[model samples]
Target: MTTDPQVVALPMGDLTFPADGAIFPGQTVVVVAYAVRHAGGVFLFDTGFREAAPGDDPELREYFQKYALRTRSLPDVLAAAGVDLGEITAVANCHLHFDHSGQNALFPGVPIYVQPAELAAVREPDYTLPEVYDFEGARFEQVAGDHEVAPGIRIFATPGHSPGHQSLVVETPDGPVLLAGQAVYTRGEWAGIPGALVGSSDTRPGADQAGYARSVARLKALNPRRVLFGHDRQGWPD
Candidate 1:
C-alpha cells in the first residue's frame, strides 16, 4: 500500500482588531502554517512567528502584540504532525515577512524558495528592516515566475502582498488547492469585495495591482476546489 502526499495545516496564532475590511474579526484572525509531504520529504510552506523579543519597529511590535503572533517553533509543529525536522527537504515562503520567515533558521541545509524581487526589496536600505527578510542560514532559490517544486505542487508568482509575493497551488485529491498566501485576505474579501489585497505598501516598493488582478483571475480560472487565505477563513465552492 502506498500513501499519497499530505498537506497539513498547523495552527499557529491569531490576529485581533484587524484593520477595517481585513479578513478576520477583531478576535478571529487565525494564522496557520502548512506542511506538505512528498516522496522526497516534507516541505513546509511558511514558518509561523517566533517566540523571540520584539524588534525596533513600534508599529510592527504593536502589530505583533495585537495579533498575538507568539507560537511554537516550526520544529515543534512538525513533531506534533509526526514529522521530523531532518526529514524536511525544503522551505518555501510566499514572502519574507517576519511572521512567515521566523523559523527559517531551524532548517539550515534546506533550500528556501523565494521571489527574486522580494529578496531585492528586502535588501534596499529603505526596506532594511530585519523583519523583511530572515536569511540567517538559508539556501535560497530565487524565482522570477512560476515553477514546480514538487511532484504535484506548483508555485505561481502573485506579487501583490509584496513585491515578489507568490502563491502555491497543489493538485489535491479533490482538485487544485490554492494556498493564497496574502494575495487575497479571505474568501469574503476575494468574493465579497472588489480589489481586496493584503499588502499595499508605499514605503519599499509597490506591487503591480494590475498584475495582481490578472493573477487572481487566473487562479479563479483554475477553479481550485479550496482556496486557503493567509490569515482568514478558507473558501469552498458551493
Candidate 2:
C-alpha cells in the first residue's frame, strides 16, 4: 500500500444518543465525515446530515428538531476544508441513514459506493424516513463484497447494523485505520460489550443485538491499529 494518502475528519454535527442502553449524556456525536486524498482527487466517506426546513418530510424534520442537531451544509463544509465539492471524484456511504447521506447531493457527478442490499432496503415501502434513501443526485457503484475503492483504501462488507452496511480500512503510515461506521459506535461497544448500539430493528437478520456483537468480533479479529466510529468520540486504540 502507498503511504501518502491523507485522511481528514470533518465534523458535520452532533447527536445526544446513547450507545446501547447506557446513558451517554451530553455525548457530542459528530456526524463524523471523512475525506481521502488520492490520485483520483478526493473521496468522501459519508455525507453528514443536512437540516430540513419547515414542511420537509415530517418524520425526518421531527427527529432533527427533537435532537437539536445542527447540521453544516455539505458544500460549505467542504469549502471551509479547502475542498471543492466538484473536485471530489467519488463518494461512499457507510450506510444509507438520513444522518449519513443527507449531503450526498453536494457532489452530483461523483459515483457513490453502496451495497446492493442496502439499495433495495432504502427503496422498500416498509422503510420509514424515505428521505434517508435519497442519494442526492450522485452516480452509484453497488458493490457486493470486499474491494478496494482506491489504493490502500479497502471496503469490507459488515452487514447486521443494516443489510448492506459496510466499513472501510485505510492503510495509513501509523497502521491500518478502520472506519467502522455504524458497525461499532464506541470503543466499549467494539469491545463486545452488550447494548452498544441504537436505532436497530429486529426484523433483519443480525439486525438486533447479537449482530452487533458478531460484527464487533469480526472487526476485532482484524486487529486494526485504530477504529473510527460513525458518531464522534475518541477513535479506538488497538
Candidate 3:
C-alpha cells in the first residue's frame, strides 16, 4: 500500500447527446473510466454505460437511443486494460449517473464507494438507473466527503453536476493524477476557456453552479501533474 498507484484510462464508448444534453446539440462524446493499480490492488473510478436492452424503461431506452449510447462489456474492457475483475479491490464512482455507474452491478461484494447524497439522489424517481447501483449483491460504502479509499488513492467531493459527485486523486510517482468525473466536461473548461462545454452544471436542471465553480477552483488549486476527465478523451497538458 505504500507504493503509488498507476492510473490508466479505459475507453468505454461514445455517445451523441441531444440538443438538451451536456455538450452542444448533436455533439458526440467519448465516455471513459480509470483503473488505478497500486500495491494493495486495483481501484476503479466510474463504470461506464451499459448496453441498452429491450427491458429497460421505455423512457430510459428512448433516452439512450436518442443519445446514441454505445458501450462495451465492462469485463472485456477491464481485461483489455490488463486488469482482471478479481483483482479489483474496490470501486468508487464519481457519481451515480447512467453513464457513470451502469456496470456497477458487475462487481458484486466489492466495496463500491459513493457519497451519501448521491445515493439519495438515485431515489428521485428518474434520477438514474436504480438497478445499476442497488441490485442484489451490490455493496455500497457511503462516504460523506473526502476520504482515502486505498493507499495513495483518495476521492474528494466535487459536487455540482450531481449532489454527491466526487473526483479521484491518485498520488503517483510522477505527480498527482486527477480522475475528474464530469467535474469539468473537457480540457477547455479546465483551462477556463470561454464558450467551452461546462458539462451538466450549466445545463442540468437544478444544477448548483456556485458549488460547481467552487469545486473546480479547488481542483485547480491542487495543480495535478495530469488531469483526466470523465467524458474528454484527451488529458490536460497534451
Pick by TM-score: which candidate is best? 3
Off by over 4 Å in 2: 1-3, 17-28, 125-128, 191-206
Model 3 Cα RMSD, 1 decimal: 2.0
Enumerate residue pairs that collide in model 3.
Answer: none
Candidate models: Cα lDDT each: 0.71, 0.74, 0.85
Q: Write the per-residue lDDT of candidate 3 for residues 1-238, one digit (tens) a residue.
A: 3566888788999888797755378878888999999888999998998877667778777877887888888889999999998898999988888888888888889999999999898788757767656678988999998999877789989989888999999887778889888988898888777876776446566467888988898898888998999989888976
lDDT of 2 by residue, 86-189 (tens): 77888888888777887777766678888998888777654437555464565788998788988888887787777788888888777888888887766656
Candidate 1 local accuracy as lDDT? Answer: 0.71
Using TM-score as the measure, name the better of candidate 1 and candidate 2: 2
Supply the TM-score for candidate 2: 0.82
TM-score of each: 0.80, 0.82, 0.93
What's model 2's lDDT at 184?
A: 74
Better of 1 and 3 by lDDT: 3
